[model samples]
Target: MSTPWHIQRMAALDFEASDKDSETARIVSCALILVGGNLPTDTRTWLVNPGIPQEPGAIAVHKLTDEHLAEHGAPAEQAVPEIAKSVAEVVAGGVPLVGHNLGGYDLNLLDRECRRHLGDSLEGIVRQPLTRVIDTMVLDRQVAPYRKRVSEEQGPYQMRTTAETYGLPWNEEQAHGAEYDALMSARAAYKMGAIAHTPYRDRPDWVRALRTNRFNSLRGVTVEELHERQIEWYRRDAEGYQAWLRDAAKSKEKHDPEAVIPTAWPLRPVPAPRNGGDR
Candidate 1:
């Protein structure tokens, strides 16, 4: 008898690209597909030749040189099919497709790449739709909606720091690279699964509802209104509050001609001296 679908393992995909605007950026990097519930007993990765030259800036960040890729990586077309097949098999067998941020980036990129690769021969087997993508980004954002003491200018937002909010220690240096990203993604999902299995799991659902409303509401607003909302939101944040207060205290006459007045203001008091007595 065949193994039950539930007995089959679910998989997670972790992908990184050089540029969000390019095709390669849409479907690049290594993947870690696991073969179990939440955590996998086995994982695998694939290196893809994005079919375009890796941008110098992107290459600098990822260190995936085109020269090395040309020698070691599989072509995008060849690699994508294999990836799709693997993902489909797992999903069809009743396992969820998990990724760090599959809903926002990785899955869409891979889907695009797979569609591009399947070309005319796209059929029910290879080109059919897949389901149950568990997005770690959505999960993390659900846990902590509005709390960033400091925003990072670099690194995967969904991976390193976000994991920390959940009491999961994520080492960016040790956990970078596509393979590691997927592994960590799986780890994050496993952690989430534990919560989802708990009494407080309803909290994530409530947050999801709020995010859905926020996203839908954003789509209804004007671009200018959206910008204002974002600015207002940031202004309410710790970093934003500091900036808002700093600008507010500045003289209108001394305001930079190039800068616009922010719509929101902060009310934070200055911190007291560390010593008991003022210096």
Candidate 2:
């Protein structure tokens, strides 16, 4: 199949849940924005009834509560299938889903939510492997650290932060909604792709902020190559963070020294414990 890495066809996704723990969280909202003709050709949003109470902390982030969901949201049984259809349409049209931090969180939530409602994950529901996703979070962090300000304590790869660094407009006040975030993720990916392939000298002067960090390596690459490179980068990143935590002297975060972070590309199923209860 031909690659769908071009700006005019990259489909963007973002989702919100009822809680912070992806394994336990229920998806409350989902958004997909398809870019074509230099603008979104189609934009879809869904509000789902998670069938669980929304946590206060999570509510503060996306502002959907149990009461609100109960009153206005569609049941997961109804919403998940429709969501799958939207994704399938994009995939069928030779477009890949792209989003920031999507592989780390949103995809996991999607897998579990699909399992809950359809007895299988998205690939099962959509009836095709979702191998075409382009996670901008992984791509930006791996290929363009020169495009960000990362540190030992924090990698600084949040969507909004990356947007600001890449000379894309951002509004903290209007962020966190599924639709807003999904659109921004698409916009950010477009900016990143331009920087990667476009000659620095040819870009508009407004892109001067990223001129010095030219990523010519991303040019002339196939979509499969781009996807596989992210797998390597994400694995290295997770393992490196684990190594750092093991060596930190005064860290406040709790990490099990024996715990192994996932090296799998995109999302991994939550590991089952002894006795194989969840397996």
Candidate 3:
């Protein structure tokens, strides 16, 4: 059988933002890593001066201080458009975009940044739906729905944790840096592709331990088909989680029944302007 598209080529994208709120967060740094083919990985990165105060918590994670960014980072107006153009070019070339929590976070943040600065969302710039995406987080959750947090130090689906799970090297010092995170996600994707394509009998003990047959469904699929599968997988997972939250709320547990998990894949919809007019 032919190689899976993810095993052949992918453009891994990541962004470090001003804060965790994707709707309001500004891009502080971003990276895109092109993997596969005979050539070495091509990495492009940008640091942006968001021209706003970053949350201290966000600063602690990515370590890009407002003072430092103001002095050295490119203006967001310039950086955001360049980032969008670069990603659009890669997507137009039919390469799948890979990242951890891409649909739930990075892509949504990028769309916000583009609309805030460039007056267009990334989808608007690309002029098409982002259908070629491989979200390592979504894939991992789908394949190993029962994976549990091994310790207080890490969440099971964090990029570093996922990298470790997949047998890739991890550097704590580089964990939150956009470039490093993007590269690690790409490496994890390669490993996941290997697992999916490898015969079950030949798979390692860890693969067998996953206790799920989902990887078998991934074998031999085109990138577009895999992308479509993730959309459904993510939607189902979100619905399940939302339902669990409602059940907890009904039981008088401390969960929010009103909490909603977005089912969008690759990019979430842009919120309407608060003033009831064009943003």
lDDT per residue as tens, model 3, 1-279:
766666677898999999999988999999999988656889899999999999999999999999999999999999988999999999889878999999889999998888888888788899898988899999889876778897888887888789998889888998899999998888888888888888888887888877675787677888889889999998998888787777774536657778787787777787778988764
lDDT of each: 0.55, 0.76, 0.87
By lDDT: ranked, best first: 3, 2, 1
Enumerate residue pairs that collide in model 2.
Answer: none
Error of 1 at 217 (Å): 20
- Candidate 2 residue runs with Cα over 4 Å from true position: 1-4, 37-40, 146-155, 200-214, 250-256, 273-279
lDDT of 2 by residue, 1-279 (tens): 543355557788999888877788888999998875465368889999988778899999888888989999999889987887787788777677888888888888888877877787767776776677788788777655644355653347877777776777888787888888888887777777776677768855655555344366566666667777778888988887677666546334764566567777776865675696662
Question: Would you estimate the TM-scores of all the predictions?
Answer: 0.61, 0.86, 0.94
Residue 218 error for model 2, in Å? 1.9
Pick the TM-score winner. Answer: 3
| lDDT head-to-head 1 vs 3, winner | 3
Q: Give the per-residue lDDT of model 1 (tens digit) for 78-144.
A: 8878877776676556566666656555654555565566742222434444434555665454444
What global local distance difference test value does model 3 have? 0.87
